[model samples]
Each structure stands twice: as structure tokens, then as C-alpha cells.
Target: MATGVMTPDERAFRGDLRKAPFMLGELEGRWKLESLEWPNALIDVTARDGLPYRLRFDLTNYPAAPPTARLWSRVENAALAPGLFPRSITGSGRVKDVFRTDWMNGTALYLPCDRTALAGHESWLQQMPSKRWQPSVGITHYLELVHELLNCPDYAPPAGA
Candidate 1:
């Protein structure tokens, strides 16, 4: 046996989620993560923590690096409404796939592992204090860089063969 984690079903599920069309686009660039106001609809749930809200995006198609973002609830620091705020995680990996809870009622957030070391990073984030859970703004200047790299209009052919 290989002797490792992940069963057949779990593996299949992971594959399916990764290939899912939920996260479209070769989204690569610097992104800013802004937290949305908690919807008033959750007031009836009677939870001991603040409502969750977040936004997510991909930041790999850019030039700088890979990045990701998330927003969590106040109580126990759970991702009540997390967004896939993509940026750069080159040292880690890139954002391959993302899945969030139902609009604002769920707490579970899922993102598929790409070339980025997201699983490890996420585990590290879990140990962080709740107060650190603040909105973020990721500016991927790489987009401009990419444009320059791909579509530099001032180009000339070589002098000779």
C-alpha cells in the first residue's frame, strides 16, 4: 500500500470539486479583499458569534505571485462567510479551486490545492487570534506586468536570420 491519507471516495470528491466550473477564468493579478457588511437576515439564528462574510478571487494569471484571502466570524474564528480572495502564494501554491458556504448561512469553506501550499497555510491561520481576522486589500500589480509581457506593441523583428 502507498500508506497515506485520502480514500477513494475522498479522492474522487476532491477531483470533482477541482474540475467544477464554480471558479472560472485564468484569474491572475493583484487583488484587494473587501469585507461586506453582515446581512441582517442571520439575526434569527441566535448564534453567539458575529455573522460571517468574505470575498474570494484568483491571483495567479498576474506577474507578482499567488495570494488568497478570507473573512471569519468573531466567535472561535470560523469562516462564516468566506470569499476566495486570490492573490499570490508562489512559495506556497496557486488557487486551483474554491468553494464557499451558502451565501451567509454556512461556516464551511473549501478550496482545492493547486501549486500553492494552501493546506499548510490554512492550518497555520487556524492558530491565529480572532482579532487578526480583518478585511484585506491585495493589489496585484502583476496584471500590468503581464500586459507588458504579452502585448508589448513596440516590437521589431531581429536584424538578420
Candidate 2:
């Protein structure tokens, strides 16, 4: 359903959707917006393994506050269960802390780009400045990071997921 008139955040989001990176991702079938309802946008991202993970982005406050993402469970129509979350960012049995299921009760990513995760991780601002969120970079910045992680050579999908 239409999410009413486009607010500033929605406008900015649509602008990012028009950007080359997002456009190319759509063309390549890498990232696809599955749904949009005001503060919530569900995006399906394809992993290198040819599987897809649906992420729900909470865009409330948006640019002023970095949007947070959670792995979505189509079956449950809720957040993906922690036990079923992706196991590792690499295939060598090492889990990347950013996508750890234990963080935020498995509700969000642990990256500095995430609003919730960045709360106690302010040091990332200087430690990983480039990865940190800046309003000017837009939502694609978040999606791009996720895309990169899921497509990296080390990414390992959860068994039977």
C-alpha cells in the first residue's frame, strides 16, 4: 500500500533508489525492495550462495538516525529466529561480530552503520569512519555494506536455512 505523501526521509530514500549503485544492484538482481510502508522497508538481498535474506529496515528518523536492519523471516512474518541466523561471514567457522545473532537479541546488525548497534560503539566513528553512517551518504550506504558482506567469499549461510 502507498505510504502516504513522501516525507523528507522517503524522498531521500527514493533518491538513493535512483542512484547508480542501487540501480545497478536492481539490474543485477542483487537487491530488491519487496515492500515499503512508511518507516519500514523490506528488502531482499541475494547472497553469493544464490540464496536470499529478507531484511526489514526501520527508517524512522532515517538520515538523522541511521536505519537499523533485521533479518526477516518470511515464514514467521517476524524477525528471523536467532538460532537460524547466518552463522558466519566467512566459511572458516568464524563469525563476523556484525552479523552475530546474539547482538540486540538478534534484532539488528552490529555494524557501526546501524543506529542501535552504534550506540555503545561510538569508537567506530574514528576507528572505522568510512563504514560509519553519514546522512549525506544515504540509505544505500547501509544496503551496500550488507551486500558486500553477504557476497563476500567468506560468507557462510546457516545450515538448512
Candidate 3:
């Protein structure tokens, strides 16, 4: 935990991760939580390519609101360049749609679980109810989706890489 004033959301999010799902994954070496500082949680996801990439999750309202997750550049200490985003996939158009460069200036992944993308996409809740984020869902609901996306067979390294 960072030495700062943590809000209710941060406290809740931290507590959620300490539970079984996140802890089991961490213990199993599926992913490593690098650091958590309130709204930002930088995690290193081990990809199918045997390389690791970091994601910085913006957890503003947290459980009440979906997170805005972005690929992170640890060196730059900023969002990864748009060109380096994992916006390509070979297997399914549905998956490709979620990893796009056309929405929100490509700041966040275009998943129904993302805060910014989920705003006007309320229809996703009814159409693909399972994909929608709800207050009852934990951070694992979103992180697991990201893990799938990164490990999917069709996933490829970014063009810049």
C-alpha cells in the first residue's frame, strides 16, 4: 500500500484482491501485482509470448464503476503508446472488436467491462450480460477478462514490438 490517503474505494479494492481469487492467482504465478496506489494498480501480465506487459487500471469509483485499463509503459511512466496497443487478433472478430484503436482515442480497451467504454454501451449489459460489470463483481471479473485477452491463441504482439 502506498503511503497516502486511501479512500473507501481503494480500501475496498485492496480487500477484494486479498481474497481467494487474486491470491490464488498470485500464488500460482499467473500474474504479479506490481504496486497499488489508490486509483492506479500496475500489474504485470505474463503473456502467451512468454513476455510480460504491464497494465495500469484506473479504478476511480471502483466497484460502483468499471475500471479504465490501459497498457502501461513503465519506463515512460505513462500510458503505452497507442501504436503499441494490442489491437490486433487473428481468430475472432468479436475479440478484435474489444481490442481496438478506434475508441476513446485508444486510451482504454473497448471491453464492456471498461468504465469509459461501458458508459454509452449499456446495451452490452442486456445483450452480453455476462460481460457487463456490476457493483457485485470483483476486480477479478475484469482482470480475468484481460488475462484471457492476452493469452488467447489469436493474440499477437503489437506492431511496434
The 0-to-1 C-alpha lDDT of every candidate, in the order given, reads 0.27, 0.81, 0.77
Model 2 residue 137 CA deviation (Å) reads: 2.2
**lDDT by residue for model 1 (72-110), tens:** 444444443233222122312222122223322322223
What lDDT does model 2 reach? 0.81
What local lDDT score does residue 114 receive in model 2, on the 0 to 100 scale? Answer: 93
Question: By descending lDDT, how would the candidates be arranged?
Answer: 2, 3, 1
Clashes of 3: 0
User: Which structure among the candidates has the greatest TM-score?
Assistant: 2
Off by over 4 Å in 2: 1-4, 89-95
Better of 1 and 2 by lDDT: 2
Clashes of 2: 1
- lDDT minimum window of 10 residues, candidate 1: 39-48
Cα-based RMSD of candidate 1: 21.0
What is candidate 3's lDDT per residue for 37-151, written digit by digit as tens? 7788998776677556788899888888888887788789887776766644653454467666666666787888888888888888888877788667678887778778778
lDDT per residue for candidate 2 within 1-161, as digits (tens), equals 45466888887787877889778887898889888887799998888887788899999887888999989986777988776666674434433666776566878888889988899889999999988997887777888788888877667788766
Query: Which of the numbered candidates is closest to the native, going by highest lDDT?
Result: 2
Clashes of each: 24, 1, 0
